[model samples]
Target: MASVQHPFPPLLSQDSADIERWLLALNDVYASDEVALIRKACEFAAPLYHDEVDVTGASLLQHALGSASILIGLHMDHETIAATALHAVPNHLQDWREVLTTRFGANVTRLVAGISDMERLRHFSELREAAIADKQEAAQQVEGLRKMLLAMVEDIRVVLIKLAERTQTLRNLSSASPDTQQHIAQETRSIFGPLANRLGVWQLKWELEDLSLRYLEPLLYKKVAKLLDERRVDREKYIADIVAQLQSALAAQGIKGEVNGRPKHIHSIINKMKRKQMEFSELYDIRAVRVQVKDVENCYAALSVVHELWPAIHSEFDDYIANPKPNGYQSLHTAVLGPRDLAVEVQIRTPQMHHDSELGVAAHWRYKENKQSESGFDEKIAWLRQILAWKAELADSGEMKEQFKNELLQDRVYVFTPQGKVIDLPKGATPVDFAYVVHTDLGHRTRGAKLDGSIAPLNTKLQTGQRVEILTAKQGGPSRDWLSPKLGFLQSARSRAKVRHWFSEQNVDDSIAQGRALLDRELVRVGVTDINQEKLAQKLKFNKLDDLLASLGRGEITPRRVSLAIGQEAPVNAPRASTQTIATSDGNVVIEGVGNLVSRTAKCCSPTKGDEIIGYVTRDRGITIHRRDCPFMQRVPEEREDRLLEARWVAKTN
Candidate 1:
């Protein structure tokens, strides 16, 4: 590979110096062969990136080196660091895949490819905030793009590498144009910072958020920084005194621990002020210290000694060791008044917990490596995804933390629109569902669809990373076939409801005309015509003749059911059964063979007195009554068939 000639010369002395520095920095963590591999990758990438500058006007080779350095700080594996060094190779070389594979190995090649794939998402990020009209929709689309970024990569390291590259870009963002700076900062604050937070990369999360804030809100950032700077000397002196006292106290108690002052970032400071509506001086954590011990017991011992040394604020204490966070973060947090009656915060945790706190999911790579089972890795990924889903709620309530314990990780499929917007759907979502999610009008007018530039069936199950283009008509409604579960035209219940609503909203005259024609045919088939339609409608519990016809036209009522009601002699107000009746609060539904059971109508299919219904036994809720032909009921798995029971309408007794 070294023998192959290119436009660029061999590594210069300066380039060699940079490579040596990188290797030296990584020497403690990486083996000799691993260090040599990183050196080779850096050498290979340096030439391809020669004379190349990124959008920030920084040397591409320097950018790659900066990114690798960040990964090294995370203690990422050699493969990840090497891949970061060569991440931009695909943009520089056409045959980069084969070259990387041949020189480094298939792992490096895959990592580089994953990086390239993620880079394509940068285009969406640039346009997301500006192109979207509705703020909520734009926020949702941004979330979709985040999930798409994760779905695009098979390896989690790819995401970490991408995060590192973004951080490097932000660090160099000062040299870029104002528009470019604002764009990059906004994207980072909205996407990458939250991503790092979710992945438990506190080291990168704090920096990314702080840098983005510096660019996005320069005035506020400077204000907070100025405040911290003004107090830096006195704060440092005070923290140093507290650290010494805590260290001596811990030593006297036979507790071994490392205590250090914790630095507070500007963005978090501003956030704390805004969230709690407090002045910076009132914040207890501004002057904070963290203690790292050897074991869980030492952690408690250190905490006890700290409290003994200072007056502890009862409300400010949190015992997270007994209750770890959803992301597996464990530490004891407390706020107290130190010497001079100054407020101080303290955090106590084991060294392993400290390592995990700093590196987050990145620490898993160091220990689990090849030993982690696929299922276990998937659980971690699921936790990250859940964090992404409930990020906003997680900040406000401890109850939301308990909600995270229940794994609600459903399989999701992410696809792109014609204009590069991401749309997330369920595992088996179809084009009609996609169309409805985008816009109900678009879904109603959808005549066909094309997947990846090729015309496909409307019922085609979408996959992640596919580009979907819905082919719509000028004016039309969805086909009734979409509501049929067996046809698989629509997979989402929301989409099916939209289709039903469209039919339900049709012109009353037209619906009655269509229904009358169908009913006349059914009557001819049964060889009966003199039947009074008004009495028949009354027997069916419809207020008027047109209501019955409209229900028939909407497919909510079948013609054979009209024929069945014709032979019955009971009046509309007749009361029939006194058998076991399990009525709801409104006394509408009666579950057969069951009594004294609470029941409620299912929101998915609100069954009325005249509609055919069934009962489903729920875990907590006694029983849920659903329409017999509800799409949700039809989709219930065979394993849950035992939950199904017979239910019917009991005539009202006045």
Candidate 2:
């Protein structure tokens, strides 16, 4: 296949070369049909984005190609590659979805949509200084932010595409301003680099780290780069010579193995120096070669060959394969005296181990991104990797889409406070829930909210990466209406519980005042007036008036019973009798001074048989019974205590 030249602008013209090079690269890695789909997508996108430019002032078409190139290097599937090509086109063309579906089919369209959604992470880009200034907290927050990104996308491939795009952006970052470079570099280091690392995309992960280091510490980067370049050719020659000798020895020993020099990147070298507080001369791995064999046995055999070829440094040998790291990294490492007494490190492992070390279980990114594994985010990434491994066999488009929907990125939404601190919440959580999640005091005082600088309803469901600002009163508690499910003001159960607890702790005076207001409202609704308070309170078993009012305020007693007990006409079809007294239910009660005046029990306090009971003569509906110590009875006025009637349960009544 002929190499396809970079397709320059004046796009959609006849002279543009076909992207056969990219297609050929995908041929062996993907099914013929999947490869064809990717070609169709690339051809469709090339013309549409040809005239565009990206944030770094590069051709948007070239940027897309660069991003697709990164995914291809990861050996990603057709959907990911195709989506990378088309992720930017929708921004330029109207009805892009219809166009995508008509040309590349629905699967590609869906992939494009997922990629688009994942790309919208600008709020994370603007985190407050407080969030990142503290090392430990920043690491935790960054880990959470990575999980948030992973959890936000419907398909794991969307994140893969995003990482690819970020890699390309950083690759061409020199075209951007110093400010843009620093900003982009910081974002990659804090978020995308670690994300790539966790996903085991070692190729992108290392480059991201190296590039970020380049921009973040320019002087150190230049110094190290200059030093490495000074003897680059000599180092390469020496490494090549060592690899040749190792490869020849392994073959002669009937051991099939691959040997290569592991160039110590500037960033990694500097990190080790600073971390270990060592001088450049003290670094044994400055010159290193890795040997990858077929199995564990072959790994030891290869290590023997390396030892026989050079004198091993006793202090530098580590048999990690026998005792793996906590994250499951496996290898045999040793430093040896090489040609001219130069120190060179050798790492021996199986090919599988090597791959794992690069982008598998042993990759450094996995441990960094998931040091705190309480969230099981590491397991999610592992599952995603498993899914990607079978991408070629995932022939059922509908099933794949459903799997994408059912799993990955659905549990938590990462939103931002106005101060830029990230606040994580369950999906479909409301702004009031967000307020409560931030602080209990904030939740209690939360009266209004501002979402993205616009005043929003308290119940508005928060989306990932939306900036939220809660408007609170100087002092107040949550409304009782917030506890009402039908009102839909709050969604978080924690917030609801907090509100309930606040109300439960309210002062008795306040409860009584509120309870009185509710009782007055109920009286007006029932048209009851001039009631004998003492008799009512005594009949209800309350020794104090305020106690009865407090119970009413707390909803321990319903207002309907107050009307019925006082002999006011009940609401139409309302229950005419209260169940508070056993005598009313059994028709066995005797009220002194009231003879068969339509007796009933008060529902507020259900007085049982053998209990001390009292009664109040209603205006018309006979005497109502109550427990002697009921809170309602205490509300009765002393002057009106005459209306209190003695009632008892008759043992013989059936």
Candidate 3:
């Protein structure tokens, strides 16, 4: 594929001042070696992307620097920042992967590869001919895209890198054509913003939503920004005064907490206005203060101090700490009558709750999406964030590489279907597993598969971004070999179960034949000759000969049971009596009939060795033992009632 060249001016083009500023911002967060790695990446990528520009006519080198700066702001690792710098290299330079791997080690190479995988998503997202007009369809499409984006990458850092890249594009939207800006803004608003929100990346989410709003709804964004700016000084002073009073009161009361003015962004204010159908004057939270304390008790205590200091609006009080939002977000919200009869909002929360609200799943819009539970993907993101947090705490540790390897996504590989739909599976998943993930019916009919348009083995393990096409029979089921571990055809347990279930529900006649063949083979292996099939079936509590054989084929019954049943290998503590009171293995049941009428417990009910069992005389079959409450026994025809007989356990001779 030809390299896609950006046609815009670079934000950092020929600007050593901008590049040095970027490096300076990293000084606080990154160590010497980490900073060196980032600088090396920039130095390496500058020549490659120097001639290229982004859609906004910004230099690709400048765009890369801008994105890396964003990751640095997010406190991302050096590898993430480095990868952001070279994200476009693989597309622009031939043999970029090999060079990157050789120079930066496997971790940076992996990060670059992840970025490359996400570039396809960017193209996929941006190729829409026009903005979707239908509100519902647009929402659903964006929602699906969000899921696909999250499902596409192995490293959550890749997602952060993507977000940073999008943020840079939005920031530099001025130079882009109106059409390109609109497309990019729409994608950012509908796709990237929600994703950042879901991942609890507040800084990225806010900038994305704000920038997208600025482009897409220029007039409204200006209106909100103008209104906020008009009273910005007054509001800041008022909030500062209130925070001062609260701080003094808390200090006097021996409380430890932080009280800060909450500056609501333009996009958020506009969204709140639209969502609540409220006038700007009615929004009390426009000038708000958030109190973050050390613990739950401190949160409540701080709330009391605020309420005591000011009279709260009766209907504006919410005790979220007592009743957290569905997504596990907790905070105390109260709107109060402040100095000069002005309305102000106060939010009191523990530091942890505040962290979760900002950077955890219980992000800014906690009530908007009340998901029942966080998905595995969401959990992985949370884990990645935890790792980032630990990196901050363990900044001096030398074991970061080993720790990263241990914590990185190790089991799951996210791949794309030929049409760009993401299918997540275990690391070693094959096309068959991919088919199963798509649909069980597709898996059942999967006859062959192609990996990246070339025929590959059914068991060929998939890698990230590999397009898989499953060739299926018009009418067929999954082969039994797919369920066999020795065949190496399937790695997914769900796929194996589906294949097993299909075989289990197969036509009884075929199952019986297969079962019979399996039993004969096992019997031959066990050196049991001329075994009474009917007696064996009864002893196993199978009502019919076919049922017993089918059970064997389905692997519900092990072959060792056959050897034990035929007395070729006596079970532990077997009763030795063999006359009128002949004892079955385990002394669970005594034969009620004469001359070796095979009596065995039924599999359907799984009657234990000592459980009471009744014998049912099956035609051309020996007495089949069943628990009294067995479903088959209760449903037996009235004519077969005579076949039912009393059976009891035999007392073993010590």
Candidate 4:
């Protein structure tokens, strides 16, 4: 494990001074509680760990204990922190067992053992002993095994510890191997961040993004950080002025709320830069003051006062209050020029809403704490689920960017249904998406729409604060043309899946009809046509004849090959024996091969009146028509001579 080429550099290696400082801070806070855990975690990890401070597991263990203390609401003893240090190593299972037994006895060892996932199994792999025939397959196997091992563990603490360790590894890895650093950063951006996001850990979510950005896009990260640093003086001044003016204005209206100013994070700044395609100077919302009032009404009252105090930027107002976002985010936002001509952003919301917005649901969870927990945080996770539904397809784009932008991008519009139901959609979402948001069936059946009480087409783009009315019909459904790429909203995976499902059902019906008609034509061509065709299907090893026809219709079954297998003679003018079945208004026509077959114009080559022709009988499908000397037709059914059916086509019936 200590070899130079080992996968992950030992956790405790390097950055000794930083680790010592952080440990000292934790000790100052928790005293013996932190000190005891720190020593025990190091000692337990000692046998597997390297003596050099760089390879020690103490730092990762300490961070794990710190995070678990917050998450599980537990003051960790030596045993818990020791367990954290070893969570990444299954090689030292005996050491962990002994430590658990000495500190917290049998129960802790069981907990520790439950999380041992054989991460070191590669050392024993027989496949490794043999030359790995395919490197691509081996990497997939490694990831598959890792996921399986993690899923097997019941205690979430193992997962939490591993999460911290991975983050630390990713952070250190960037400087060690730029390629692996970037690759692992992307993996974290994709899998770990989403897991943290799903778990409602907004703090971890932000850290994942922030750390990944730092590694994968270092220049951009540095630029954003430098820009923030340069503007720190201006930012503090801007928000302070906004707070003064807002408080005075609220006092004028006899309204009171808690107003605090906070700066946007560095990653958020970089995102604004990339999405807006603007320099740092162009972004106005560097420092925004937030207002958390006692109730929803006061939130709006405070907003009105703030607007009255500073001349509002007319086009830069968002009223998420009356029309909350689909994710249940409700806030009033406005940018205004404050004292000294500084542009300041103001956000007003209820206190509870402010908490939910920041933690996004992590603020409240009814976990196994003795104390009663909260509920709305769990509901906020429901918002994450909705976002995930939209995001799943982006995984393949090989870019975490769209997720970053979509999660952080601020431009939005709030509209209302005619019944006063608020709909929060992206700025450019058309009435079609609005209809789907109302109900998918409404989207499928939408006839026309009314925007601001005026008739409009279904493609009408919604504006903030406008009233929308959807006109639907029982006789209508989505147009096939709506699936065109130009219809932006319907192009989303959810909408595409629904529309595709509908059309697939339609195709099934069409295929069934086509299959039946082809069966009818082929059976009628034979002398015993009126007899039970079901028994013929059984004779051909088909449970249902329709399946055989469909196979013929879809080109899965070659009629000429079927004929040759059953010893039927092929037609002279029938289309050349091939898999492709040509469709017609009369329905699909194919060769039936289970019984004696006949000669007809081959559907594949559709022989003209005076042209030389030949016919071939198929074992499964009906007779196939072909040109007289076509090489493909002559090639099928090389041996069977007695199964041939005689057939001739008369002059056109019409």
TM per prediction: 0.74, 0.64, 0.67, 0.46
lDDT of each: 0.79, 0.70, 0.71, 0.54
lDDT per residue (tens digit) for residues 374-401 in model 3: 3664664555433221212243355764
Q: If the candidates were sorted by their lDDT against the true structure, best first, what order would they fall in?
A: 1, 3, 2, 4
What does candidate 1's lDDT look like per residue over 523-591, in tens digits? 664445466788889888999899998887775665655654543433434333232465554555655
On lDDT, the stronger of 2 and 3 is 3
Off by over 4 Å in 1: 1-14, 20-28, 93-104, 133-137, 367-378, 390-395, 398-410, 419-422, 506-553, 557-654
Can you give the lDDT of residue 474 in candidate 3? Answer: 97
Q: lDDT score of model 1?
A: 0.79
Show where candidate 4 strays beyond 4 Å: 1-63, 66-86, 89-91, 94-180, 194-200, 314-330, 366-387, 390-654
User: Which candidate leads the pack in TM-score?
Assistant: 1
Which regions in candidate 2 have their CA more than 4 angstroms from the true location? Answer: 1-15, 18-35, 127-144, 231-255, 300-343, 356-411, 418-420, 426-428, 439-441, 448-463, 467-475, 481-505, 512-654
